[model samples]
Target: MARRSLPSLRPTWRRRLTLALRGIGVLFVLGLIGLIVAVYIQKAQLPSFDELKSSPNGQMIRVHAADGTVIVSIGPSYGEWLPYDRIPAVMRDAMVAVEDRRFRSHIGVDPIGMMRAVKLAVANHGNEKRFQGASTITQQVARTIFLSNKYDLGRKSREALIALAMERKFSKDQILELYLNKVYFGGGAYGIDAASRKFFGHGADHLTLSEAAVIAGLVKAPSHYSPTADADAAVGRAGVVIQLMVETGKITPAQAASADLKRVALAPEPKQNSVRYFTDWALPQLDTLIDESSRPLEVWTTLDLNMQRAADAAIRANAPAGAQGALVSIDRDGAVRAMVGGTDYVTSNYNRATKAARQPGSSFKLFVYLAALEAGRKPEDTEVDEPITINGWTPHNDSRHNSGTMTLRTAFAYSVNTVAAKLGQQVGFGTVADMARRFGITTPINTYPSMVLGTSDVHLIDMTRAFASVGNKGVAVTPYGITKVTANGDTIYEMQVDRSHVLVAPYVAAQMTDLLQTAVNTGTGKAAQIGRPVAGKTGTTSSNKDGWFLGFSSGLTTGVWMGRDDAKPIPGLHGGTAPARAFAAFMKPATANRPIEPFETQVTLPEFQLEPDQEFGQPDNGGFVDENGNPIDQSAQPPTDQGDEGAQVDGDGNPLPPAGDGRVAKPEKLDQDWMDRVLGRDTPRNQPAPGRSPQRDRPAAAPPPERPADRFQDSRPTQ
Candidate 1:
């Protein structure tokens, strides 16, 4: 029975094979449909040259300095693209030889080249990660148009299908032209023509064989082999491309041997020098000016390249070793002219100028003084010299010596610690802090007694903005770096000065400027004085930790800070030292040609008044007196006033007699009325009285009694 069943099993096998074939056929049809849909999706996303040309956002992104000098850029303009006929044959051959030797023979994708790349990748065991990229010119063009600057399997698959479609649609020459025009050569250049001009200062047609090879070599990794970015790597890679050209017979062996892989001298392009400092500060404001988009826009900033270079140089030259510093300069229009984040931008990307929060040292004193000025205090007002304790903290003068008494002008000029502290106390710490915030210092200030000592933290940018306001004549101008932004010739964003009245009166700013000018001319900021009119202040933190010079001319205001990134004390360095030196050096040249316009000082003071007690009183004979008003000779009397004893006086108002041990006796306490009359309560202690003898009450001499008779007798006998 089993043998009989076996004969029918053959038919069952035929049915099973038929069913399997049907299933395979169905799957194949589904895969074809899916492939067609993917092709349609990719084609829909592919951008044509017409689309690129007509796109409203195709304009290049340009960054300009305050003076309208282009510093950096992205994207390409019409002037950057070139026609195929403009390309040199050597460059065209070199690119084809190195990237795809059989470029003309292949339809779009080079299967042989892909297989070779795969072989090399396998031989290297993935250790040489970047050994393979076998995309042909067509595939590369497709990727550039439809994908991002990233490597992935998804991109590779899309690139393959696009290459096939491109071959069916366009000629080999057209594909090659698009590829040359579309590939990125880094350094902000996007095509062979732009790359040639950027790296060699010449057009593609004029590129030498060696230069052409270098450009072609960059197709693999533009940043890695960019002549401006890395010269040695670029030259090394160029040598490989030249060798490939020789092996492919595109270039003669002799030509390859003669070719020197000379590094092409790149033409100067815009460079971003810690621009993040300014951009980060300007970005938030930019949002209000323009809508967000990936479209390229041109942002015209108020930065002056020369001034920015000068400011950067000053910060670098004066910044402490292993330390970071920041500098910001703004013009009278509240436009930021220059900004520097640190010494070397390439070493550290951290922008210290706008982001770092640091105690401004005495630079913060400006705000305190501004507060006092607003509170109806005159620069010439006299303040007492004495120890003042506020909030359990004692603020000492920079000199650490009691001034005894000083005018507000002198106090601020010398940065007298005691005077500023007292003034801050007079105008409430909260008031001073609030005034500072209104002036652009956003950081919270400690309301302690030391706040007047600039114990509060602030960024250099904010500090510069505050100082710039003074130059703006009492208007607190919100500093803006970017002036305007445009996309495809349409105005998208415009920056205008947004200012507020922080000072009580515009004339008050002028008065403060006068005081600051005095500081530059003959005070602590003497080192910062330039030939032109300059007004500024010097600030040195306790223990010489931070040095700062914040000053301004008629047109520009800048603040500089130098200190260790860790806030460690720098020995023997103060604001008036290196920081001021750098500021003056920069300001001298920057303002040399400008006119010397003095800041307006409207408030005037009357001549200083003299107190009665400060005048000399009538001369009295030098004589000791008793409590009963009896005069006593110094020879017959002992000293009256002893160590640590109060001044002793007799009823006659003369010094009292001393005791037997030669120690002066302590005088009894005088009545309040007597002290008031004698000390001249309303007058200073050093004034002189009218018609008083300048020299009186000094010690008198003993009388000469007689000469020796023996001396006279001896002279007569000799004669």
Candidate 2:
């Protein structure tokens, strides 16, 4: 029967099909050879393992100014290195469960996983972009190390080959470590180490399952899943990761549900730089300051709401284009009252007040003066103001008129550089540096003669605290912002004032204060005078690269700085100009209702005889005067000199008729009640959760009384 069939075996259709099959097989073999050769060539060009480990990423660390107010967040984290053993097991489980369910059974590349990915891609109408990736953890490691994010066959073939090599060369744990360390987690972070610290103020090893899930979810698209950039999207992505984890039995359904309810809800955060700067500074301390298992925090700060408003307004109104401004204020008790870390939070979140270390110019002269006073030199003592060289670095005075021999008082008033240099030399550079350190200059000091002219860099908060010693009658203060911190409404930590020892002798501080008072009262810092007893020094760097005004009243010490973020010089900018003026503006509004008080001096001031002189040195010659020297109308009640009254006072201080529709300016108390509400003093029983902005009410904010000269003149300086 077989011999009979063999005669018909060579039918036309069968012969043709056989030839076609042979030709197709030959083409397929040739194509496979070409692909292998192409892959080898591409793999040779791919980066080695060392190079891919250094790629950049987004990492965010936030700062806050007030309680429950996020001020700023630092970004672009340079990833912190962490070892495999240091990583939490749960964190590893979360990542593996969501990223590679077959991670344990795979040999570099997973055929089963690839088929699954292909199936999903087909379901999505062949859109590979939406396809679930089949890349094993080992494959990901290879791609991350050796390939760009391109969707091409050559890259894919090489990636698989490299992954197979990696699997042969390293253990499973090693591959996992490599992947975890190199993966990008958004907010300027790379690696699990940086991601954990950037978002939770801790290391990867300590991450909870929920936080780990979020980090694992971020591997797909960092920008879309960035908590600060888009909280809802980030949380939604985390939910998907959790779903995968649960489906794989890596985590219990209850665990996934709990993480979704708690972890995802914690993603959203505020972005303003002013409050963020403080929060960023305080966040890390929470781990040390409170129990690790505490719930979400409600950190209270020593930020006076009124003063915070003043600082914010001053920076925005006075900083020039291309120049950012920062202001920090503290009370004698070392409580930070207010701070402005940046001018426009939206433009740049870099906190000049907290992070920048710029030359303070003449503002740092207080330390030099303090050193001089402590060395037994009086304010009236004389020093030569001639030009001098320090290690061949010549230093010059701001003006020719400032040259020549002058009193220490005069030198300080004009912010004369030569005299400060002379003092630094005489008193010793080490002495000056030590004194500055004692007075709260936390930034490392460059103990050179130029340091006398404020050539050294220091943070604004520390610099403000230095002057606060003058305000506190020589008592050194440790500037602090966090007053209390609660976790999920439970008390966790509280701040205790550490102002104790006198950093400077009372007489020395008094003499220094007298010298600085001359600066604000009549010299370089004259624009900073707030119609009250206040003293400060003006500092303008060489070529006006930086301008600073550090001053203090009896109740508050404040420092202001203005300069370009790039440290470029600003045209026509001076410490005595806008910076000083801004200080005055902030104080005028901030100190409205508080009774004027006198700073502690070596000797009791004459006008401050009774009740410890709450007159701000406004002589007891019986009346108060405005900044323009206009006599203050101090009648407790409304004035009765109404000329058919409808209007009270004109654009000027002169009384206008009642029919006069011209708006009048009158000083009023700051609405502290509204401030209390903001600081979480008395929350309404029916308000939103903590950190959400509540409906506000302001009943006390009032306009400044107009001066008679302001009526017809455009005297206001451009901000």
Output the number of the lDDT-best candidate: 1
**Model 2 worst lDDT window (10 residues):** 613-622
lDDT of each: 0.66, 0.65
N/CA/C clash count, model 2: 24
Across 89-184, the per-residue lDDT of candidate 1 in tens digits comes to 788888898777878888677888778767876776757465456788887877777666565557677777887777766677777777777677
lDDT of prediction 2: 0.65
Q: Give candidate 2 misplaced runs (Cα > 4 Å).
A: 1-273, 387-394, 401-405, 600-719
Please provide, for model 2 over 58-96, each residue's C-alpha lDDT reduced to its tens digit, 9 standing for 90 to 100: 223333455555544345454566667877877787788
